[model samples]
Target chain A: MRYETLREQIIALELGRRERQFIPIGLSAIDDALQGGLDLGAMHEVTGPAAVFFTQMILRQKRGGAFWLATSSPNEEYYPPGMAQYGGQPEEVISVCLPDTKDLLKVAYEVLAANVVGCVLLEVQKPLTQTQMRKLQIAVQNTDSLGLVTRGAHTGTTSPERESACGSAITRWYVTVVDWSHEKTQIELYLVKNRRGSPCRWIVEIDHATYDLHLVSVSGE
Target chain B: MQRMICIWFPFLESERLIRQNHDLATRPFALVMREANRAFVSALSRNAGNMGFAPGMSLADVRAAAPDMLYFDADPMRDIRCLQGLLRWASRFTPRVSRGGGHNLYLDIAGASHLFGGEDVLLEKIETQLEDFGFTTRLALADSKAAAWGFTHFGSTKSNITTERLEGAARELPVEALRLSYASTALCQRLGLKKIGELTKLSRVALTSRLGLDGVCRIDRFFGRTAEVTEFARHKKRLIEEEQFFDPLATNAGVEAALERMLEKLCQRLSGMRQGVRKSQLQLDRVDHETMFFSIQLTRPSIDVNLLKRLFLHHFDQIDVGFGIDRLILVAEQVAPLSCHQLSLENSQTQNREQDLEKLINELSNMVGARYVQRFFPVDSHIPERTFSRVAALYASRLEEWQSPSGTRPLRILKKPVSVLLRDGIEKMAPETVFWHGRKCHLTPLSGPERIEPDWWRDDPDWRSGGRDYWWAKADFGALLWLYRVSDEEKTQWFVHGLGS
Candidate 1:
């Protein structure tokens, strides 16, 4: 009886199409691939080298309070005041640096579940297992806030294969900085996995003056 | 602006335990004193008072109302010490702070009330800080000390005493507020005189004959006709708050809780003085006559009570409480005036950002070791490693103007450069692939050969190694690596210097 009642509500949201509502990420090609924009009220995993830039992109895309949950990895220190240079209010970003990845994930889940923040950006050194992703996914089920997990390069173990970090995320992205020169900072974003839309790729340019995400080319180009 | 502020602690003897262990803040508690065969309530907690328990009430009546309430023996000496400590704590607000009779404290703000915005704000600050330290207090501000003292004891609890309103407020209180002798009070009551106004209605000469000179004198003091002279103890420039536990605490949790209460009191004292602590000492007195101490030194003066508690909590593991910790004392060893930053209307957002960053830095320092948390400051050195130096995050530098990097640099740089391992067949200069991190480092040099010469003047051990030739490379394995080659007089060496996004 419980499962039936739960399924009926699930069917209800599906019929109403409220479950797929997204706050647009503001670029046509990216938005088209995302089936609208960034999926709302769900966890999305963004990985790779240029993930911080991608993380800050969502900060510019989303308004209101943004919680940046980082770890005490001396190498990967977050300069929140530097966010002001990124054209976002540094005061709006509440940065929390915890001891380990477990605490980081715990804080991320708690913050997302609370639904008090407009956007939560979690940068961790470890990839999320399926269970961890499910826990994070469960947290964002009720709120319209954006939960972005920016997975950094994990340097443990001997396995040559890259950990997919695949979980129950609505979408998974791999960001790579292709060009960071005196002229322009170009990046390649690969949509490795998408729950609703087809996988796609795009090359975007980070504007020098505005720091806005500009789509330079698509997969065909 | 010779404004006098009176702070009345109604339950000084009762709330000591609750102040130390605020867990009992809401629970009903009473201070019982026995005389002959009868027991009486000497003092009650604010919660107990709210339930209609007053000093001098019979213990039988108290237990009949609430049987499960906790009780303690009356300790006037301990209560006086606590009151004196609070009096000393108020010295942070003004130099003219003085101890009053019983549980009251007086602060001669004079011109200083405007320092906290106004008299009302200063009173609110005192009330809030004292309440945080687990005491219920009544506060009032008046032009004269007598009126202020009278207003707190006798005036309506909601009375906000200004000089203009002092006269009316003092009169509205009952004549018992005069603090007359028992016989005098009973005689006045027999005459159907329950208010101060009723006593003052009779001619002075008639009242003198009827109630003696005490009634006239009491009324005189209430009306501010005579000077309310009080000799204040000389101000102590140091802060030391101590608490004695009846039953020794056995756990680090309890020790931390005691330390937390101490920090709250210390911070309140420091906040009043507009000063912050640079170093503090926490001493633990054990039942075995062994005393243990831990010292905390902050990078800057900060009155953040919670942060100080957390910092002391880090050193909690080092303290060994044998048998049990009987008493805990926290002393501010080093303090400096922490002037409030003037808020600008146009730059409020920027200032708030700095404040948030300051709080965040303090929180991080408490969570991690002080050495582990740092903020970046651009150094005046061309050396790749010397371009930026990490300073304690608490003392964040205001100067953020960064000298533009001559070239793009890696965001994540290792503390020490990790040498790049070369495969047997790969060329040193243009190697297509190498080995690192238990995997083949598939290297693709995007930009390279930017030689950085070491500074000659600086005498440093780490930079003793010669200059380095750097490269920005994208590995085929999808990670960006900053590879460098160290130039040695004997032989040139290769190493993977840093990581980039």
Candidate 2:
């Protein structure tokens, strides 16, 4: 009887469901602002004057290892001070960067689809076309991993894609820097789409002293 | 009125404690005002009270009452801090906590009595602790807060009042213990109603007409006729663990050490839940409006704090502690029941080989970028040019492909098959006969043609010249090549797809 049970279990193993998990970002303000932390199996877009700050926050929020792929033009620089500022260690951050955009995307997709990466962060210049975005979206869903794509406006053209790919992503966010001046920086996070509920937005002031982002306010749009 | 047992420790200050002992716990012996300047005798030591001192006496009068009665000011902050500390220690008894107004801890231990072997045992435990702390605690448990308050102030040792039985117990207590305002007390006196029992028997409308809303509320609370909700501040989201540092830690190492401890505490909690975390978010909250967060992701679901801490070490460089981190919070998310691994019966050699291959591929994939790995897949066609497809990475089971049964394929396939001149309806597809370096005359064998139609779906009008016939040819030089004939051309296009090796 035990052997029969064992045999059944072994057979079941080959057809097991994909497991999804989440780690709450310790920032109560952000966690409350985000409703809960970023959903573990979706793409979160961080865009704004300083998307890097929230990206760092999200990266720190996911303590599960992330495969970070940063793409840049030859002359462009990516000297993000927060990578080290938020507990991102040298070894845990796997970077695959190249001068070519397609190669970078190809590499990003390959790494994310390997099923080993817990969360993936890809920093690109412009918004990817609908078709290109769909390919990446499919890759992430197929592998059951969280894929966060960071597209900074300063890098180049910022245009909305025609259509997003299939796969009912858990959540999507658009991080925008609402205000920054006089030694103070405020970030506005817009939840563009969420299948679970209506969209929400939160504004946070980035503390220069501790590099901590504070919840200045929130608005449900 | 749901029961609220608000335990008020009147003489909580150790130095000002009116204890039954001499040299009362070392400092100046005086029951400092509860809200100093509010003129309520918060605490009174035996020495101060014995020297003809009493609560509510003006400080000047108290000074006059006992010239040598050493007086000290009351500190609400310190008292509340001490109260909170005591409450933390008391939390082991129950999860509910309500501390409001000074030195009053309301414990709702109504339903939890039997759990600790009944009310007497629970009260005994509290009493023993209060005694150890040298506090004069007036313990009361009643169905209503006001009645409980009356019992706390007036009941004697034998009262043994439980919340369920407090209504009758409060009848004999003086009306003053009802905590009626001085004005209400005066009105009650004017009406010649001095006992709580007398007030309880009065009509509600009559009570209201006499003292208005305040009177009605007081009577309602006192008679257990109204309900009160005591808001106990709890963590917004459930907290696994929390720690604070007096001095803000500025260095990464200091923060890491603090995080290490938090992880340990978090792991203990997660393990108890019979679960593991897939991700842990670390927040380094600083005092001066600065916060840094580090999120670490685990490859496998785990409850192991050590491994979590180790993973966070990688992103340690990202945290920018502009000022210093005073508080640290680690929240583990994405929890799941840890699946147990069952090792297979497959022996060491096969397992070792698989492990070696996986490691080798992983290393190469990481080095060359994961996109660069590739293997060849058979393209379903007899024509040499359409024979294979390139598949990416270690996803392929193996690179080996079956050779065409009747043909000898080549050492190297041209990226695009090249067309060459033919001699009299026969193709010069043989590498030996078709002089490269001008050497010919080796034993060459050529196979008959296998035809292949154009891929009409992919056919460009300009590129669709026609169908082609393919042949497998061998030369004495040990090279096997694939040659094809375009029907329109008097030449065969030669391409190499594979070697026998």
Candidate whose lDDT is highest: 1
Q: What overall lDDT goes with each candidate model?
A: 0.73, 0.58
lDDT of 2 by residue, B369-460 (tens): 44544334455554444555544333444444334422333322344444443333353433334432234424243454666667677864
TM-score per candidate for chain A alone: 0.83, 0.68
- TM per candidate: 0.52, 0.34
Over the stretch A1-221, how does candidate 2's per-residue lDDT look in tens digits?
A: 79656644542332232443445655575565455565555555655434555666666655545666665453223322223323443234444556678767877666656655467888777766656766776666555466788665422123223223223344555554444332445656666564434566677776544656677777753
In terms of docking quality, model 2 is incorrect
TM-score quality measure for candidate 2: 0.34
In candidate 2, stretches whose alpha carbon ends up further than 4 angstroms from where it belongs are: A1-221, B14-28, B31-43, B157-164, B235-501
| List of chain B TM-scores, one per candidate | 0.47, 0.46
lDDT of 1 by residue, B1-501 (tens): 457888898877767887678788778899989999999999888788888878899999989989998888888888889988998899878888888787889889887877888877788888889888878888777766767777788775524677677666666677677777788889989998887777777899998988788767866776667666767779545699999999999999998888878888888888888899888888899999899877766656889888788778766767787799999988999898885679799988757755654554454455454555455566666676676666655555445645455655655556666665666443467545667667776677777788887778878676677677788777664566777776565755666666653
Displacement of residue B174 (Cα, Å) in model 2 is: 1.4
So what's the TM-score on candidate 1?
0.52
Give residue A45's lDDT in candidate 1 (0 to 100).
83
- For DockQ, the strongest prediction is 1
